[model samples]
Target: MLYAILAYHVEEEVASWTPEEDATVMRDLNKVHGRLNELGRLGPAARLGATEGACVLRGPRKGVVTDGPFTESKEQLLGFYILDCADRDAAISAARDLRQVNPSAMYEIRPVKLYLPGVPFPRTEDGVDA
Candidate 1:
């Protein structure tokens, strides 16, 4: 199975939602997640905190610590989902369904790269080191 990392970005400013509204949206999203689970395609999904709640680490020694998001952008990354699908087309289909539910949000789907067990590095299409 091909694994995809789906990144979701909110299109508008972060506004507080009423408890009822929040529950409704959550229910809708969960329903889709349940379907994916039944198909054995859903791996994991999570909604992350706002950028202000994040911390960044950088440098070879991982000694550099920075505040909040690395950069400021119009849309902030709000959540992500890991999906297992038959192929990229299947992943795209799932993304399209998700987009219909969250019409104002942006979703990015990228294949996840994995190294085979006992392999020191990932393989490349040209048979070169990745």
Candidate 2:
């Protein structure tokens, strides 16, 4: 099964982090990612941009657009991870590992019911989409 781990955090708090602090968190996360890679469970992961640069579209034909995610809560979605897991427990375990290193952030684990079919994006030499 596939799981989507949605990461949510207070935007103001995260944005206030010093570069060193942010880098330290990333390094810690990379340790978790390394283990997932070894298990061949890591899929696509991303750190989303600020909500200020995001838009919400609604209404007919989804043409009604609004600024920001404007979530109903204090936390804004900061990123997500896709993992291939054996079961719900396995998915929860992965989210738990993530939470350990990011105590203040919230991780929402959900089973992926459908994955759109398509070829992956063309990658640059560095293995990232160009």
Candidate 3:
């Protein structure tokens, strides 16, 4: 199974971290990443650019574009990790390890659905599971 571990943190608080603090956090994350790599569980991972560079395109009827994520929340999404694990428990364990090093960071683990060409998606306009 594949799980997406989404990392979240306060933008202002993260930006205010000192050089030493930033280095320490990165060091700890690197250790976790290395362990995942050895286990062949780490897939795609990346730290997103600031929300200032983000934009949201509305549905076709409106077709309007808006700057920023425009979320009604304080914590902003920081990064994400895709882990190939045996099950949800394994994925949760991996996320827990990361949370220990960065207590302020919140991780959301979600199962990933793969989309294949020529295969119909599960949900349809009629609300039936295909």
What order do you get sorting by TM-score, best first?
A: 2, 3, 1
For model 2, how does the per-residue alpha-carbon lDDT over 1-130 read when each residue is reduced to its tens digit?
9999999999999999998998899899989999999999998887877778899887887488889687789999999999999999999999999999999999999999997636676534322445
Q: Which ten residues in a row have the lowest lDDT in candidate 3?
A: 120-129
- Output the number of the TM-score-best candidate: 2
Q: Write the per-residue lDDT of candidate 1 for residues 1-80, one digit (tens) a residue.
A: 65555555653433466667657666777788888989888875666666776888877865788885665657777777
lDDT score of residue 23 within candidate 3:
82
User: Candidate 3: which stretches are off by over 4 Å?
Assistant: 115-130
Rank candidates, lDDT, best first.
2, 3, 1
Q: Is candidate 2 or 3 superior in TM-score?
A: 2
Quote the lDDT for 90 in model 3: 99
Q: Which of the two, 1 or 3, has more lDDT?
A: 3
Question: Looking at candidate 2, what is the lDDT of residue 106?
Answer: 97
What is the RMSD, in Å, between candidate 1 and the native fold over all Cα?
10.3
Q: For every model shown, what is its TM-score relative to the native structure?
A: 0.76, 0.90, 0.83
Kindly give the stretch of ten consecutive residues in candidate 1 with the minimal lDDT sum: 119-128
The local distance difference test score of model 3 is 0.85
Error of 3 at 113 (Å): 0.3
Better of 2 and 3 by lDDT: 2
Instruction: Point out where model 2 deviates above 4 Å.
Output: 122-130
